[model samples]
Target: MRTVGLALVLASLMAGNAMAQPKWAIVVHGGAGVIARAHLTPEQEAAYRAAMTRVIQAGGEVLAGGGSALDAIETAIGLLEDDPLFNSGRGAVFTAEGRNELDASIMDGATLKAGAVAGVTRTRHPISLARAVMEKSPHVMLMGAGADTFSHETGLEQVEPAYFYTERRWRSLEQFLTQNNLPIPARPEGAAAPDAAAGLAHDEGKYGTVGVVALDQAGHVAAGTSTGGTTGKRWGRVGDSPIIGAGNYASDASCAVSATGTGEYFIRLTVAREVCALVEHRGLSLQAAADEVIQQKLTALGGDGGVIAVAPDGQMAWSYNTSGMYRARLADGEPLSVGIYKDEP
Candidate 1:
């Protein structure tokens, strides 16, 4: 009888301790797509690793210094947005019409508060605008010229169209248009041709990337996403990056997710929310949920790429079906770190 009573007491004590333990972490992704081995040269790989390290360090510092999860997530994602290689901010791909249209979103898990901006031009930082819309306005999302107006009204820097122009993006647009028959009108009607018809081949050489989900010392969760819209996209196409449950989503009582891959398919799957659902509904582990959605479901559905996820308990997972993904993480004891390409992990 005494033994049974002692066992019950110990079990209750263990549960209480587990509940009291601090749980916090951050995971991030560069955009994801058809990442192939041949595409990454050694020098490029090294550069990616170095960039990941810097951002991870910056975000981890915020968390370690007792900053809010929002601050940490914003800090980390900003670094990736600045890197030209990832196709989010400066390196954003060109539209079919040879212009830059960017999208971004951020979610605060604690309050289930969220904000997003889509198809914005001239706004220097899409994420900043998204954050502003979340706190300053009653709206959850804004698009196109309207988004730019809000940014200007709120005192966010507005760049001219020239600020977003990049030769690389221009070339990418030209290549896509050329394949569709150069000198053709800027608009291509209907859907893009299949892989064979339009010569729509996946160029593994240029993979897209986004960044950061952080759980800070106070156990709050935050997630953010930013992306240059797709390369050679027509019809003013907007992607999942600006969609809350597709590219990014978070909840204080559950988890946070940052998604990468073919934006269209991700939107179809509602990939970010699916991760949280797996945990809350199915009671699966965080890593298990990520693998199921990013690796199994997304892959089975013919979507390529990956995601970064963090449970409220601070369990972190990064999973992808591509040849590689740009990712890095920081835990309780580890110092700042970085990872580029696929091979480093």
Candidate 2:
């Protein structure tokens, strides 16, 4: 009888310890750039906060219910992509040709498997297509019409190009054109100036990408990123969002990262991979690695943007050099939180 009682006590203690440990965590970002709190009206701030809350809750529920990190991250980014407030999916910025060209990528940390799509025009959810590429196709990346065709072959929903149109985005594109003294008419084939297309100003903090990083109950890490590329981008330009290791990276040994900001800079720096490398090679903590990469390295390179990262142990961290980043986080036993300005808590 005493032996049986001792066994019961040990079992109970083990159960308690498991219950006390955090099961999962998720972090997401809309975009990152020169966002200032004073520039936003109170109503606008409230709306952004509400949207962040909704996204975190939706994704958090999946993590809490024992969903894979891949599912949670994809679910979170898909919500941001569908919302017109962010620079992805329905709200993607217009290219130099006055059209939307989207890019997206997804990564699984356990297996280091990744998939990406670039310059896809009609996919309703580019992130889903990214996953499809990862799972259904053998390729790690697909682009332009090829990606759209693969998306169709995989049975992902397709939307008309008109579905991406938004008055706000059109206005932003017009403003960019006016600032550069470029006419509203489309440039002739092979005549577009690379500088005119590449250097156009972006909306505040809307360098126009959305991303998510999640740690699941099973201890797997996953990340995803989606964007409409740059405003006034030409010649089928693809951004870091669709480039694994630049915009998205994950590793069960280190962390999962999703980035938003200037695609060119991110690509040059390989921002996501740098963070993971720091953690794996230098033994830096996830927070320290993320900060070094986002605040120090990227800043030194004149890159402005940020990243959301989650570690296998449920630690979460985000860092940006820009004035603000649209970000949110949820973890076991913690309150859901969202922020848009540099000074926000």
Candidate 3:
């Protein structure tokens, strides 16, 4: 009888501890591409690592402080959008016409609410505009000049079209256009003369979009994706980053997903929603779902890139087919981790 009583007490204590533990997890990705070690100088590699570390630490603080998953993901993605190293807001890649157009999407798992903006030219932070559309408007997406106009009416910070330029990205645009045998437009009016950013491989690790997926203490999941579209893309082209279910998806019933890669392929496969569908309908683990979609399905389609996900049960996973993907993660009570190469654990 004493043994049984002791077992019961211990069981109760275990349950109490479990209830007290907070469950929050977050994952971030800068981009995915043919990033080989030999291509980058040591200084270039260090820059990416330090930037990813800083972004994850900021996200961790939000989740640890009991902030919503939506807030955490938006905060993280916004920072990535601002960083010139990744291809989002500042230093975004240029279109064939020598202009930068941004796209972004955000979703709330608990409510299945989502918002997106495409071809937005003036907004400083496209992720925030996406969230504002979700909470403040009745629509799911806005596009082009209309989106920029809406941003102005909504009182979001706007920037001169020239603010997105960087010499590195400009060089990338010129290279892509030259290699493709396409007409290369003269550098935009605001761009300074190019410098020696040419030694680094332009298409190495920064080929896709920036994304964040998070599961908060409230058991809600959220995701956001932002990008400047592809280098040397058509003047009005839009990518998967701003399209929910294509590049971004969230649902409490399954998981939140943010994808980066060939936009047309992601859109055709509905990659983001497919991950959640596999989790909800096939009982797959978060990692397994991400692998199935990114590895098997996307690979069969001859596509490149990857995805990051967070489940309601605190699982966080990332999968990519490229040689390297700039990524980081942090969970409550767990140490933060950041990685770049496929060889990394």
Candidate 4:
């Protein structure tokens, strides 16, 4: 009788510990573009990988501490936005007019609520502003000066347009102008030219966005995405990043998805929602749905890029049609995985 009681007590303790352990997962992507190992120097590759790892770990800490999925994803994307290495906020690409424009979106799976901002030039963290729109305003989307004004009203951080000025991004604009044979616009008298070597690789010029999808301990999922839009974009172009169904989608019944790539194709296909539909309606697994949407549907339309998706069951999937994607993942009881090239573990 005594032995049996001791065994039962031990079993109960084990169960308690298991239940207390965190059971969430997170996946993030810097961007998906024509990233070939041969084209990237060793230093550039290492830098990208390090940045991704840092972002994922930062997000993981939130989940481990019992934060909501929405909080984790927003925190992760905020870091990326602050880093000048990725093309979301601080590192945003230059428009045809030599200015930086940014966009971002965030969605809550539990409530099916979302917020987005587009074509904003001065808001520092667009992802946070997107969340503010979802939580504070009655509107689902805001644009241009309106979004900036809301950001101010909401007391979110704001910066001058020049605060986004990075020499690397400036050089990218120069390269684009040179390649297109467009006349290089003269800089203001006191403005400085960017270092010639500061620009990203030529092929990486397009498709630079950052996103995250996460599943928390309570089984809620959330997704968020941010972007500087495509390089040399003109006429106030907004990419899929700020579009809810295209670049970001979340649902407790299925999965949360955040995408990067050609905004037009994503918008036309509603890529993120399409992936969720395949899971909700067709009963497809998260991996199957993401693969089909990224590899087949988007490819058929001449679109390229990838997505990070997390299911309600703590399963995560990342799929891309490009040669490489800057991605990282962290799941309960699994080793952290970060990769920039296709063949990496």
List TM-score per model, in order: 0.87, 0.89, 0.93, 0.90
| Candidate 4 C-alpha error for residue 182, in Å | 3.2
> In model 2, which range of ten residues has the least summed lDDT?
191-200
Index of the highest-lDDT prediction: 4
- For candidate 3, the TM-score is 0.93
156-236 per-residue lDDT for model 2 (tens digits):
999878777766677677888888887675532332222211222236643778899999989999999999988877778
The whole-model C-alpha lDDT of candidate 4 against the native structure comes to: 0.88
Task: Point out where model 1 deviates above 4 Å.
Answer: 1-23, 182-207, 335-337, 341-344
lDDT of 2: 0.86
User: What is the overall TM-score of model 2 with all chains considered together?
Assistant: 0.89
Per-residue lDDT tens digits for candidate 1, residues 302-334, read 988788988778888888887777788886664
Say which candidate scores most in TM-score: 3
Better of 1 and 4 by lDDT: 4
Residues 237-316 of candidate 4 have per-residue lDDT tens digits of: 98899999999999999999999998999999999999999999999999999999999999999998889899887778
TM-score: model 4 vs. ground truth: 0.90
lDDT (tens digit, per residue) of candidate 3 on 1-345: 999999999999999888654499999998988887876788888888888899988988999899999899888988988887788998678888888989999999999999999988899999999998999899999999998988999999998887788888887788888888998887767766343333432355435799999989888999999999988888488888998999999999999999988898899899999999999999999999999999999999988889999888778899999988889988887788889888996
1 against 2, candidate with superior TM-score: 2
- C-alpha positional error of residue 72 in candidate 3 after TM-score superposition, expressed in Å: 1.3
Pairwise lDDT winner, candidates 2 and 4: 4
Which order, best to worst by lDDT? 4, 3, 2, 1
